[model samples]
Target: GEREQVDFRTSHRRKDGTSYPVEVHLQYLQGENRRVFLAIVLDLTERVATERELQEAQRTLSTLLTNLPGMVYRCQNDQNWTMEFVSPSCQNLTGFSHEQFVETRQISYGETVMLQEDRQRVWQNVQEALKNRQPFQLSYRIRTAEGAVKWVWEQGCGIFSATGEVVRIEGYVVDITQQRALEDQLRKTERLAELGTLASGMAHEIGTPMNVILGRAELLMRKAPDERTRRGLETIVTQVERITKIMNQLLSFARKRPAERQGVNLEVVMLDVLDVLQERLGKQQIEVVKTVSPQLPKVWADPDHMNQVFLNLILNACQAMSDGGTLSLALHPIDDTVELIVQDSGSGIPEEQLSKIFDPFFSTKAVGEGTGLGLTVVHGILQEHQGAIRVTSVPGQGATFIVSLPIYSEEVRHEA
Candidate 1:
């Protein structure tokens, strides 16, 4: 038998639109007597293309999971701490890497959870689930790579082998930092509000007796023969009056009053407030600069409540400027509302603590120096008047508070 020259070729295209070079193989079946020629065509293009696409998808998914704000992980069921898989997010959540903890066994995942006494409770739950072949659910804090810690909730079922033996544990973890912080703040605020209510009740009950004592002391001072006795009685009477004022402020903040609205001239109210605090301002050397418009229209508010508002604000301004600075009071018309501005050249409020100034029982002053209800009472009073107040300050420069009230006209009231 003699063989003849033969040539064959084929073409194939990959998934990525790449063409593969053609190749052919020739073979003969020796068992058959005649020349039985066989040809085989090899096309590896499709398989190669599929593998490349799979790799690209995996890379994209890995990048996404790694940059996620939560932790993703996979662990084996063994007590020896074998890791089937761990995401790069483990570094952000638990201060360990996927490779370091999985392949090299450089860290223990369970040990890094939390060091508190409650950690034992978590371990006990995990042990019971593993022994009973049940799903595992746990939440705990974990130390992270940058020395930061975060809360994570893990819930996952065990993967079983063909024989029903547990094989692996896989789950996701989320950063609950913001949720926990809100919860803490809510608890604190609730406590403070409760304390404010109790303090208000106590102040009301004690105020009557304190006033009686103060009146008695004043009467006794006038009649005391010895100068030292008279001086001591005067001091006691002054302290009792101060305490009574603080209690009134607390009660105002804690309880709401049915507003007795009437035509109120803001300029007249400001003048009265200045008169009440004139002696105190003089003692503190706080200069009052009033720029109230004489022709300003009236506002609808309770006269007494409005007077208290001005007193609280002006007194606070005078107290703030301990080094003797200007206390500016200005009233101007803005659209349908009148704006009252009280500014002081004192040490300004800190930015971080400004938002809490209206919160009950929150104060920057030392204990006994303040009841922390001054601003809260002011806020409540303004709220009753259907007005709004805002504050702007810069540390070391000063603070400005603005109060806006709707203008009241005789025509509007008569029409109503």
Candidate 2:
């Protein structure tokens, strides 16, 4: 009889009476009358231990991959850069499944994914690093499957052969969109700080003269000899006042004044804003539609600053619908904040210009028509109140500005 199949693992006693793993193979020998059976017991301890270690290592590696904040990949160096191995996180990094890249030739990692402006530069950087046998570090943008642009930071090195030829490339890539945004914000903050200093100095230098001129004009109006003279003096005072208002906004934004906190009802504030804009709304044929929830909690903010915020937003709405439209003001409470929406049915803001809307001196109005600081003032005031503002718009449909303010609490201070 020949050896039959090995039965699986089993325990076998050693010569010293110690038990160890073994696999048994049995052979049956045909004998005269009686059968002789031969059994071969192969040691399984090493194999079993090795397998256990392998499974444990696999579990550890899986956990590591799962917890990684980005995608890990191995790819070829040739054109199209065929992917040989891709981690599960690739889907989040590229909006494409890891399976899509594994052994796929349908797309090049650069031409298809990396932004057109960044593709060539990325390839050059990676290849140069590989040529020098150094790891490459790159930051670039990728167009997602949903037509979104995202920034990514990648670090990789080439795996080479004994002959100094590149065998493969391995790397980890992570989404850095939020990081880039934060960096941009920091840069903006720095710029605003510088601008604030300059504005503070200029506000003092010019403020005195502006006040003197307005005061002199008012005095002249009081002593005007005729109606025509009085009317002319009144016009001068009005223009001076307008200039003063602009300066005040500039100074306020430049100074970053701390808010004087009070419990403010957004509904009341919005109604006051609308009351001030009633004449303008009627002249422009703009209808006001307010939807404030009755149970909405009051927010902790400066009454004056909050009034300014509402005024600016309402005025913005009126300007947007110059040819008659609807202004919708909606307020609701969410979690610890009050969400207020001011939507306008007018020509919407362009996507490209939306980001700049809150920058100082950024305006959509004609020259001499606006200081371009309207929304910037609104933004500054909101920030002082420990609030946030977001805007949404379509090309021709309209624009919506959402304001989120923290609800009032004894623990929440004005400086928050």
After superposition on all CA atoms, what RMSD does each candidate show versus the true structure?
A: 9.9, 4.4
lDDT of 1: 0.78
Q: What's the TM for model 2? A: 0.80
How well does candidate 2 score on lDDT at residue 215? Answer: 94
Candidate 1, 1-416: lDDT as tens digits: 54544456667677999888555777655553666777776775776688899999999998989898776667776443456677788777676788778788877766655645556676678667867878788777766767676777777666778987777777777778778878866875576567669767798589879988988998898899999999899889878987887776656645656777888999989998898888989999988888977689888888988988898788778767877999999999888789999999999899988878777668766676666777877887787677999899999988899999878977645643
By TM-score, the best candidate is 2
Q: Name the weakest run of 10 consecutive residues (lDDT summed) in model 2.
A: 1-10
Off by over 4 Å in 2: 1-9, 23-44, 103-113, 143-148, 210-246, 254-257, 292-297, 332-337, 408-416
Highest lDDT against the true fold, candidate? 2
